[model samples]
Target: MRLGPGMDYAVAEFPVPEPAPGQVLVEMAYASVCGSDVHLVDPDFHRPEMVGSPGYPGHEGVGRVVASRADGIEPGAVVLTVPSGRFGGCFAEYQALDAGSVIPLREGDDLPHVLMAQQLGCTIAALAKYWREGMRSAAVIGLGSAGQFFVQLLRARGVEVFASDVDAARIAFGREAGARAVHADELAATVAQAHPEGVDLVIEAAGLDATRALAIELVRVRGVVGNFGYPEFQVGTFPTMAAFRKAATVEWFSNAQGEPGQWCFHEALDAIRTGAIEVGHMTEVRMGLEDVPRALAITAAHGEGAAKITIAIRPESAIFEGS
Candidate 1:
């Protein structure tokens, strides 16, 4: 699927590329539609790489190394691929990526389970950077994929999480993930009732003007406000008067930081493998490659109870199992 400006997309059949030296050709099994992919289609939001130029617009997936011109990654190994750059994308039959960008999957790894490594890795990186010790509570606005994972991560670290979302299913999922879930309208009042001084940290995962403002409003004086969602348009005023009055620390994170071998991706992988993190509620929709354009449209509209939608590129039998 090729993505262009303003809801433009098409499925174009093309010959798969041969892997260059130090790279591997992967037969993509599953690819998750990211929030950024939805933003790239907005007419007003001009994504530099996607606007005007038609390119594949996906970054998270798992596949088998069909052909390896690399030293470390072996053929027949199931690996997680984080696609970036002009040529990198996984919403297709096959993808060629640098070996360093691919992480070998272990035996007993379920396809859907490992599909969350990149997304969870992103949350892990951000929380690791700003999550403070002795912080007892947090308010995570927007119980989407990132927010759902945030609730679990915070609770695992011994922080009480006050989660809110417009969707009832999401609120239920948040509660299942160990958060005190409430409706968006009741978030402030609920948090205030729990901690009169406000939560120690406020995470804006909804990526909307109201949610952003709510994050600032719900944080205690000198507390941290972490913006995890990427909105297509401008959200709230940056460092507004209210934020200034509270003197809250505002931090923004989009990419998953830290070394692949050390933090983030590795940490997320370990957590998922050990059952420390559960993503059953994250990928709310599942489709196939032929449904990519439709899936993008639904995700862009935030419709059909969709949070994280995954494209099953190949049949399960075709996906190589680590043997």
Candidate 2:
């Protein structure tokens, strides 16, 4: 399915692409609908620049290279792909991608798990620069997939994580991830009473004005606020005076900087491989390629008890064993 000329999309058929020199044709096994993908499809959040865009809608995918004209990548090798403006995207049955954009997966990697690595990689990249040592506590707003991932990542680094979300299912997932889960309405006061000086870090993953504002207010003086969620439109006139008074460092994050070679992927893979970050929870929602329209709609509404919903482009047997 392709993104809209407006707030609409339709399934269109195309001939299977043949690999060009230095490119590989991949048969997609699993592709994930990320939070950003959800927002990008909504009219309230859609960008005019992307109206009538021709590329597919996804970036997180795991698949087998069915044909390769590239040297390093061989036929049947499992690989990863990301969203690229020049190369298009992966929300389809097949994609022919640049060899450089495809990262070979390890032996016995699960398709869905590898896809989880793609989203986790973005979080890892942000933390690489902003997360500091000696930060003992953090509050993650929006206990969705990203928030749950942040909880595990922070805990691995020995930071106490407090999380909040309006969704009960997500709140439960946060608790299972070992975060002290709370309702969004109670987040600020809960953290204030518990830490007094406030948390050392506040991660805004909800992508709402109220939650973003709460993140800023919940951070201690000189603490960091990592804005991981993207709102539908620009948020004009921020509460800068409050942030200023607290001397906060508010950093907006995006995973677009690094591609296949980023250390973030390696770190996330290691965490996954070691079972330090559990991805089983993320695989709760699954569908087939034919269900793309409904999946996109559900994800955009932030409903359907979603975490990381995966589309099975191929049978489960197609997933590599022992991942």
Q: Identify the leading candidate in terms of lDDT.
A: 1
Each candidate structure's TM-score, on Cα atoms with residue i matched to residue i, is 0.90, 0.89
TM-score between model 2 and native = 0.89
Candidate 2 residue pairs in clash (backbone atoms < 3 Å): none
Clash-forming residue pairs, model 1 = none
Q: Quote model 1's TM-score.
A: 0.90
Per-residue lDDT tens digits for candidate 1, residues 1-323, read 23443445777777887899999999888899877666655555545555333236677889899899999778898988875522347888888888878888887788887899888888888887678878999999987778888999999888999999888877888888789999999999999998888999999987887788888889999999998857536433554898999998988876563355636888889998888998765655788888888988876665456568988888757775432
Residue 40, candidate 2: how far off, in angstroms?
A: 1.9
Write model 2 residue lDDT over 204-309, tens digit each, in one string: 8988777778888899999999988576455444678999999999998775435446667767777787788899878868988777777778876665677768
